[model samples]
Target: MIQNNAYIELMKETKQLENSVSKISLRLKTDQQLIQAFLDGNKESIGILVERYQRQLYFLCLRILQDHEDSLELVQKTFIQVMEKLYTLQNHNSFKTWLYRIALNLCHNFLREKQNYNKALSHLSLESSGSFNDPVIQEEQSLLLKEFLEELTEKQRNAILLRIYHNLSYQEIAEIMDCQEVTVRSHFHLGLKKLAGKLKKCGLTL
Candidate 1:
């Protein structure tokens, strides 16, 4: 009995040490490094990669899908697709952009299948009115902004969302959208112009 108890304690300590080492190693590696590790048959590296971007991907899906449960499901699907296709990615350094592209494509497909283009903008509150401390005023502004966003073209709305919410550059957005950088700028500017006109008509400026 004493020998069995000692062996169990030793096994527990070994597992704890292994877990600690894995976490530290994961933290020290970049996304590219982790991807390479996974490609080299280290399956544990993929978990770290998922942990790194799961939340951001979730919100990205949520913004486009406008459904909490659907967003969660899409995030899982996105990672599964990534796992299957990771071996085919040529530019490992662009994994973030590639991951986003996959998620966006999935979102677009979901939207098309559901025929639901009117994505809710509640998660995308306008930042121009930071002075509005009143919750009622904030809600009103959010609804107005949401309506305006819904009016814009899908490309325009996506460009604006990627730029503003994700803080991606025009080049990055272009890569994800599979469009030219100038085209992205054009869509964003045109969207903003239309939104500005609508806001101005309502005695608001953005």
Candidate 2:
């Protein structure tokens, strides 16, 4: 009986060790390693990168496009473009910022095309997709505020989206946007001020 208890303890310790190693491996897997794997013709790493970023990318696109179908389509195209340009990426650590830059440029292009075709939205028509009730009014308020943010100047719009929608800090936004952090902060503050004014005039306030 004593030997059986000792054997059980040993097995438990081995299982715990294996679990710990697995966790550490995932955490330790950097973008650099993943990029190297891709360069070495490992397709699985590319898939892992897509899995890691798909949701975040989707949300970012949705914030800009405000249409679920269009957002998903844009994200799919972004991933495809990323794959095509994988060889051109120099610094693996810059992948996130690079991806944001690409997606943002694509959105700008799309907006430009839409403008040419005279299909640009006025930003006030972007309604959250659900029945409005007293309970969810607070949540709707924030989304509407974000929608109003799209009306700001391009720099302010990008700064607000990067900071508020994507939850990036001013430093990260500056890096992705190729501007100084002070510029990003200035844009965000001014953008918020303009957004508040617009919302107040429209009779929509949280």
Candidate 3:
């Protein structure tokens, strides 16, 4: 039954959203401590850092990528990339931003590749059987919000994610995103416009 199926889907999505919120709220920044340990050339620190960021990070990457293996691979690749670039940790203060940038870049690349593959598979199935589909769209509002986010520019997408998901400040976002405060502001505006347009297109509005 459509009703039963929708109900089941709603329950699953609710559970996933609750878990994601709890995961992200956990002490997010073991960044500096990890950096200190990493700078000392202790490989264990790299593992520790990955453990600290793995949850919300997977959530973040998962949002942008395929629902199944992409998140797992991105999280692992993010850690590996950080380990290889460990010597570049100029300031422990910027570790969170730095780690995010690396992860973000990887997510974008994965999304690009995934999109190409998705196109090839579109004729095979209109339903998204890929694991990379949005996982947080439980309620009507949450579903709408996810749709709005999908319409955002990449920069806007990252800005909103950093602000809401990662809980980074504007200054911190600027540093991680490698942009000025004004550009951060601009991205927010552009992102908002795009989201609003999508809402209008979807016959939904904030």
Candidate 4:
């Protein structure tokens, strides 16, 4: 029974991957175009959207959850929500930030449920301490940055992640976080200061 279930799951994943590839072959130029296609019942349009944002969303979730499987699960859920709610997105230009809001909300729920923020941070600190020989320094920098970010309060961390990693404006972050632009700026600057001080103690510079 377990074998049959596993086989079924594998086939489902394979079919999804093939469908994704077929959609991606269209090479849609803009997110708005993709959304229109999706609204017009072109399911492949969503495949394109997922392909574009999945990596960044995955890393964003990883930085928050500090768990691979949890991040993957949240990314999947984010996309599912995006597909379901695509009709409600009024401003196509804001789709990226809107998608981010979905992810951040999901991450918030997951973190609240686990109530293990400190534990997650500690685990990331330990993980970051062990590696210096990674070939991709950019990736290493991102991991180290995430480890440092874990030291922050959730609001500060989210602000910094959206501002830095995602290149979101403070106004956009405020909208996503349901906070004021001033609050977003405060969280981002304070988070950066805290992270800088911590890194300085470790003889590292931001």
Best by lDDT: 1
TM-scores of the candidates in the order shown: 0.91, 0.70, 0.66, 0.70
Off by over 4 Å in 3: 1-30, 117-150, 197-204
- Whole-model Cα lDDT per candidate? 0.86, 0.74, 0.68, 0.80
How many clashes in candidate 3? 4
- Report residue 31 deviation for candidate 1 (angstroms): 0.7
Order the numbered candidates by TM-score, best leading. Answer: 1, 4, 2, 3
Give the Å error, residue 155, model 1. 0.8
Q: List the residue pairs that clash in candidate 1.
A: none
lDDT of 2 by residue, 71-183 (tens): 78888888889989989988778889888888877777776877731233334233333344664675666566655655678888788667765788788898888889999
Please, what are the lDDT tens digits per residue for candidate 3 over residues 129-160? 22333444224445565545654566887787
- The lDDT, on a scale of 0 to 1, for candidate 2 is 0.74
Distance from true location, Cα of 139 in model 2, Å = 8.1
Clash tally for model 1: 0
Better of 2 and 4 by lDDT: 4
For TM-score, candidate 1 versus 3, the one ahead is 1
For candidate 1, what is the TM-score?
0.91
